[model samples]
Target: MSKQADSSICAYAYCSHEQTGYEKHFFITPASLLQHVQKLDELGYFLEDITCMQVKEGFLLTYHFNRWEKPGRLALRVLVVEEDKTIDSISSIYPGALWHERECYDFFGIVFKNHPSLIPLLLPPEMEERPLLKSSEKLRDLYELLPGCEQVLHAPRDEEFGQFIKECSQKGK
Candidate 1:
């Protein structure tokens, strides 16, 4: 999907830091990943790390970022399916992503396009399979791993999520 469409289809979901380990969880697309990350960069958020997991839908890449002034972390997620296992390199915005990206590549076999060096960081160059990837039957949806999302992932009302976000925003203030 186009970046605009990907973003327009979903709204940001707020999570409690004390209860969920993060303040906000955003579900974005690979096409829109750079811009969302660029905005965070402009706001002085630092890239903590990049992690990846195999999900029933696809490979879910979670980019974790934080700021010294902020009290909690924020996660930006992009789902990459088997047909296209690539994402834009964030090393340009946050140089630290260079190493983290390499690690993700090493295990999950994700291709970070335009990366300075896409070589393996931990695995052997001859490794044929992505060690972190599991068989199809073992994969699970991203929502299952997310706290509170399980309660609402199947909820028929957007109002419920909107209200949760509003409450979280107010509590943060």
Candidate 2:
């Protein structure tokens, strides 16, 4: 028989007013991050979604929960440094989270610890850059020159589009 990597565990639940009384439930601390995932087998909450957002500080892990009686589901967050963008995986909690986490990893380049399979859920094989991280002007230029450039070239010339172009141009892209 093989021994599991974890030997200790802790669990805590806290409420946040910002969650509007739904209680932003979480089982935190480094110790529990691994073992508590096993408890989820008996607890019944299933992983719903995983995504990353680029903020002023760094990428934020957003883990959504479902299949639980608790209202507002749950969101377990983990922060990573801009340089050391990685996290211990919770795949043991809900296997389905693997796909979601992989997609997040693909786009944001965050690591999921202990994930059995961590691979791209999107993006082509030949892609050389992370498209979402591109500057606004580069995005505009790419979209403006996409396959159907002719339709985009003749679309309604709204003032909002002009404003977008002006911003991109001023940003020195």
TM-score of each: 0.77, 0.56
**Please, what are the lDDT tens digits per residue for candidate 2 over residues 1-173?**
11222312111122333422323334233334455445444455566677776653455565665544543444554445578777888776677878887787778777888999887778775665665564544333322322222332233223332343355346642
- Which of the numbered candidates is closest to the native, going by highest lDDT? 1
Clashing pairs in 1: none
Candidate 1 lDDT over 63-153, as tens digits, reads: 9887797556777777788788999999998999999999999998899999999998988898878889899888877666653344333
Model 2, position 37: C-alpha lDDT score: 48
Candidate 2, which ten residues in sequence have the lowest lDDT sum? Answer: 1-10
What C-alpha root-mean-square deviation, in Å, does candidate 2 show against the real structure? Answer: 20.5
Give the winner by TM-score.
1
